[model samples]
Target chain A: MTTSIRLPKELKVRVSEAAGHAGISSHHFILQAIEEKTLKEELNTNFYEEAEKRYTQIIETGECVSWEEMRCYLESLQSVPNPIKPIARKLEFNVKN
Target chain B: MTTSIRLPKELKVRVSEAAGHAGISSHHFILQAIEEKTLKEELNTNFYEEAEKRYTQIIETGECVSWEEMRCYLESLQSVPNPIKPIARKLEFNVKN
Candidate 1:
């Protein structure tokens, strides 16, 4: 799939390397990646139709929110009519640490 | 669900705008978006555990291959031992055009 191209250049190189090491083409490698991503997203999501409707939007926007913040907001919705919603921001992973 | 925070800045503003329009917080808007995305991905993918294993890799790499390209590659795999796999490439969207 054109999946590999959607990936960062370094990742494309890694996928190719993985494919080459396994004696397969980069095409197969990307297919597996897309399938894997799809499955993972399904497991985390609660709504199917909603996802389908928003797929194009999500892709075009390339926007994402973390599960933790969404969960907290949802939990608050049940109790507070005017709940304090978390602001949308970037992941503070600080991966290097 | 620190999900909304994972979204891009523009998306964050849009979510907040939508939330304000609907008399809700941006948090709820983002939560819905994440759920929708998750469901959409699941429908497209065939495997589950493989997806879980690759989520991190996918996010970090940010690569994407189109479904059409991937499907062709897979079909070739069935017929050719050394299928001339499609090379991973960027989408020729040319959205403006």
Candidate 2:
């Protein structure tokens, strides 16, 4: 199918240059770029939505642990005099949760 | 410099496993992952805000072009009797915009 489009000039030059670099006609290059750009936008939209949902859940539940806290907790586990027992206990606790 | 935290058990095990897989002490692995996750979340928040602004602009201006339309337009350029001149003219037009 054929259609008319009115693109600003700079974009056309870019498409032409991209086509030259890729060893394809400008038409093919433009189509490919449009396809790739559209797919990326769609994927990003989904990712953002999912992340937003997870963020809201974290906020509501107050169950999300900060990275700093998690890090510090891990650090203390190492400094304990009987590190093996505590580490093992923590691992067992983690498995239960 | 130091703080106490209470994490559920499953996460602790996963961190330990990850640390083992990476050939690092669990303490170091947890610290690195925490740092990486924090940075990623911060970056993603900024990206989402920027993308939302751009999406709103496109909606407000009605200037967002569909991929299908763009693809078809590129295809038409190929079948044009005088393709080069039109492509050049369009590119110049784009530059002006």
Candidate 3:
């Protein structure tokens, strides 16, 4: 499929240069970039939807577990001798402000 | 930071319904979904760029190898005698049309 995309002359120049550096045609480079981006977005959307569905099931059924407990359990599953087991962690809280 | 997003009434209704089913506020649900999509897109873009860069390097350095050879190498690495090793394969040719 062929499509027309309008871009600023500078941006077009940059893309052409990059495509040349990559030893590929400008069209192929753009197509590949777009394909990568679209695929990523789609995968992420599906993952989030699945996660939300599971979370909803747990919440409505009163089967929810605290993030702290979940983290501790995961940590315990790792080798005890590994010091890297308890690395920097960022926790997400579901509490409403 | 918060930004207002305009959506059609029907789309809004769908989002609201989904939020209610997920047992979360529409705002939170939308935020989570957007986050998931953005993350996925970013990761995919990076992956594709890296692959393209490597491919370009191979092309420019005259170190190109057939996709068949690479697939065979990967298949050999798998625990063989397993029929699953040689599953359906899609070959990508760099030849320009």
Write down the C-alpha DockQ for each prediction.
Answer: 0.02, 0.01, 0.02
Can you give the lDDT of residue A68 in candidate 3?
Answer: 67
- Candidate 1 residue lDDT tens string, B1-97: 0101233355445445555654655444433443343444444343654786666555666555668888988998988898766654444554784
DockQ, computed on Cα atoms, for candidate 2: 0.01
lDDT value, residue A55 of candidate 1: 71
- Per-residue CA lDDT of model 1 for A1-97, tens digit only, reads 0101223455445555656654666555444443443444445443664787667555666555668878988999999898877764445554685
Q: Per-prediction fnat values?
A: 0.00, 0.00, 0.00
lDDT digits (tens) for residues B1-70 of candidate 2: 2222243365456545555555776555544433343345446666887999978876676556555555
Fnat for model 3?
0.00
Top candidate on TM-score is 3
Give residue A83's error in model 3 in angstroms.
Answer: 68
Give the residue spans of candidate 3 off by over 4 A. Answer: A1-97, B80-97
What is the lDDT of every predicted structure here? 0.53, 0.51, 0.58
* lDDT tens digits, residue span A1-97, model 3: 2233444465456556666666776556555554443445456667998999987876666555566666886787675653433433334557998
What TM-score quantifies how close candidate 2 is to the native fold?
A: 0.31
Badly placed stretches (over 4 Å) of model 2 are A1-3, A8-14, A65-97, B1-97
lDDT of 1: 0.53
Residues A52-90, candidate 2, lDDT per residue (tens digit)? 997887667655655555676778787766443222111
